[model samples]
Target: MKHSICSFVICLLVCTGSLASAQQANPKYDKKLADSLKADAYGMKMYYLVILKTGANTTENKTTTDSLFKGHMQNIGQLAKQGKLVVAGPMKKNDKNYRGIFILNSASMEEAAALLNTDPAIRHKLLDVEIYGWYGSAALPMYLPYHEKVEKNQ
Candidate 1:
């Protein structure tokens, strides 16, 4: 009985040590992947501010304004297809007064600014475009795969 109890304790200690080591070894971001992301960002990242436009004087020219809105969406779709857009949509509820948002990836702010300037929405005065620098972590929330595993186990 004494020997069995000693062996069980030793096994438990070994298992606990191995688990702790494994946990420590796990990292949120992989070094190689992060390096690649940094490289990608060095070339691909450009900051953009999406201006939300609201309908003015809703009482008159509703149809004309609606047609203009459709054209704006088309321009956005074109940009998205060309991989210039990162994120685009309207503002959430309880946010500032803006009809939509767009995140663009370009070589420089000037290039992004130029692109926005050419947009039909801006030309038609349907919306305004604000360009800014985008600076953030390369790793996405979903990139941390270990969190899912930990949650599953729990």
Candidate 2:
């Protein structure tokens, strides 16, 4: 029993030492960019993760639905342009009825909720949202510009 315990302790120590030595620093770290993105020491910051679920109301006619969804897309673009929304996309068919997700750059849940309310789909109950505080890379928005270059569709 004593021999096994000592072996386990030594193995744990070795792994811990290896991890410490393997840790690498970011050579490209930019203080100005970090400050602008409000990044912490680990290059992460807080944002809101919004889960768009199937709402209770699903009775809208096709024409109405089309208009609302179009408005919804417009609202998403507007929010992204305003820098209030960092990410947004729809999900595939699923059992949970999750419709889409949005990563919002808001100071508070209230602010996030208010931003969501602007969406025509959410406003009309075509979609409902579940908001959660999320910690993620502060550089998330930095990829948006690159996405434009790669996206084949306009």
Q: Choose the strongest candidate by TM-score.
A: 2
Pairs that collide, model 1: none
Off by over 4 Å in 2: 1-26
Q: List, residue by residue over 22-77, the lDDT tens digit for candidate 1.
A: 65533354667656554352323234656656534344377877777787788776
For 38-110, candidate 2 gives per-residue lDDT tens digits of 9998999999999999988789999999999999999998998898998999999999999999999988999
lDDT of each: 0.63, 0.94
Specify the highest-lDDT model's number.
2
Instruction: Note the clash tally of each candidate.
Output: 0, 0
Q: List the candidates' TM-scores in order.
A: 0.54, 0.81
